[model samples]
Target: MASQVDHRYIERLFRAYYSGEVAEKIFHSAPEPEKREWAFLRLDGPMVRHVKLTSIDDLHSQLDPPPKGIYYSLSTYEYPDYPMPDKQRIKTDVAFDLDADHIRGAVLQEVSRCKSCGWIGEGDVCRECGGEVRKIQLVDDRTIKSISGEVSRLLDRLANYLDVDIDRLRIFFSGLRGYHIHLEEEPYRSLDSVERIELKDFLTLDGVEIHHAKEPDSAIIRILEECRDVLSEVEDVSVRQVLESLVNSKDNPRHFTSIRKRLGEDRVLRERVSRTVRELCGVNIDPVVVTDMSRLIRAPYSLHGKSSLIKTPLDMEALEALDPPVIALASPSNNMVKVHVDYVPHLIWGGREIPSIHDEDVILPEPLAIYLVNMGLAQGLRHV
Candidate 1:
């Protein structure tokens, strides 16, 4: 059964957070503060949008009762507080969102619990009462690493293939299950929706033509070398041999025509090569996010309502070494809290392996306790 969230406790935490140094950091990190549109999701109400703030003091005053989630626009505007049609767009940064849910091989942990008997176990029906079961998804290390690899690949492609300046990039852990990369540099910033779509297609290798080409492209060559394991599964021994030869001589441009002809005749081999190219070389990103000019990204250092984790900014090194438990410590807390766990998956937090618990009261660090309550895995008891 899913536990009821302690809304009062979470609200108190958010209120305290906005009055501190982190809120100041959020204001300072915002680019073109006056030109960017701000939006806030209230704890008990709908989202408030098209807000414009001029200074840090204004930001503090506006967040008198801190919101559940905060966001700023990707595009700078002439009249930021106006409605969409009236707000004139000056320029917009190129942004990409890479999420674990979108990644091909990422695994999400699931736990099921019964509502009627308070039974915590796997499957659709409870063993104890045969009642309905509720399933919950939890973020794990495997998913994080998988998404991180995609981020690294995106950064590499932006710098090497697209000629984007690395200095203009701003990367952030999206507070839950993903990373956001924003390119604020020239040429990229001025690109329209149509142009951004083209850029998205390039990065994802969408509609890329591999067969019937005069020469083997870099994408095909890369797939041949890196995806040899996949290619080896080809049923035809002769076709497999041809692919292996292509892998061995990937650098030699002379072998391009012969290999293309051979692979083109075999439909299975052609399909395999196309699929492998996208899977291995192309980045997995949200196409809608890439093309949307007026998108609102999570405000850096703000708390995510669902995860109770901050939307943290990152450099390459920080991103590479990201540990979720360590990051969870950043949530405002110096005390402990008591919580009633309905069920939680075996998870490692604060360098300790937390075994799966069922209907037990546990004392945890404020951040962890809040995380559980927010995630619907536990109900908050009291400050310990």
Candidate 2:
């Protein structure tokens, strides 16, 4: 719901950035650029799709006033500019999207804004004017850090377990929340949608089955061992004892019957164990992104319209010490801008905590101002 002025101002900023040398450098770094179909989310909200940009100049030409968001197909096609059904897909890079919102225990605040009276708070209706409201989820730093840990785990699994070459993998911050991993190597690129789903199942353990045989699956044993603390939270003392005994049994077939019996008797315990296995041993990734052969992903170094932050590429070392606020620092400007702060959830920026604000004028760095305005939490006034 950003005002027209705010949208135009943000678009101007993006246009300037996209025209600069820095953006050129980043854009050129993209792999196989001409093979993917490009798409843009325009400032006025329509999408321009199935476009092909063969060079940096072609890309910049499309920027004009600059689009809010940029994206490219994961699959390389023979005719990158053609419509989806008509285009012949050559191969698709395997990709994974890990979002902070999908992580358990993420702190979320419901921020609501009334459309009729411009009143903002937390609820379905406005307190001041009793008007219809729109709500959005705001996450804190803890959630981001948790997702970062998951990213690390995923990288480890990809490199060590799946034997993916380190050189072929690319990591990027999605700019809004979470990370995106792209595997551009052979075997992975040629995998069909079904094969991709099988890979997703391996990583997330989405449909893992527990057998009632003499020799327990090593994966189940690993899950039980790793989720010992989670199992301890089971309310039934007998169930907890059985799980603990099973974990100590070293994949012994003798304990399987007892554990199975206990699980069959208590539905809650069965559910708890299944949930724990997924939470502890599996990566919480967007399965659709992994399985979809024709997925479109955020273009690297492109600005995320909602946050005005760049979809930044990162090395393994850089990812280990990544700070969410630092990503915003990569935005085009840092100069102060005055804006009417209508309402904002509690936010952390530039290593400082900003308390929620409502109905006041404040001077903020240009990047922060653009972010707030783009998110419809503030209205632009003028440059300081």
lDDT of each: 0.75, 0.75
Per-residue lDDT of model 2, residues 164-193, tens digit only: 987678888787677888898899999987
Off by over 4 Å in 1: 1-5, 114-119, 124-134, 212-214, 217-220, 223-254, 262-272, 323-330
Local accuracy of candidate 1 as per-residue lDDT tens digits, 102-160: 88767667787688876777777889898998887676555565578788778877886
Task: Mark the 10 consecutive residues where model 2 has the least summed lDDT.
Answer: 208-217
Model 2: lDDT of residue 122 = 83
Error of 1 at 37 (Å): 1.0
Pairs in steric clash, model 2: none
Model 1 lDDT, residue 76, Cα: 92
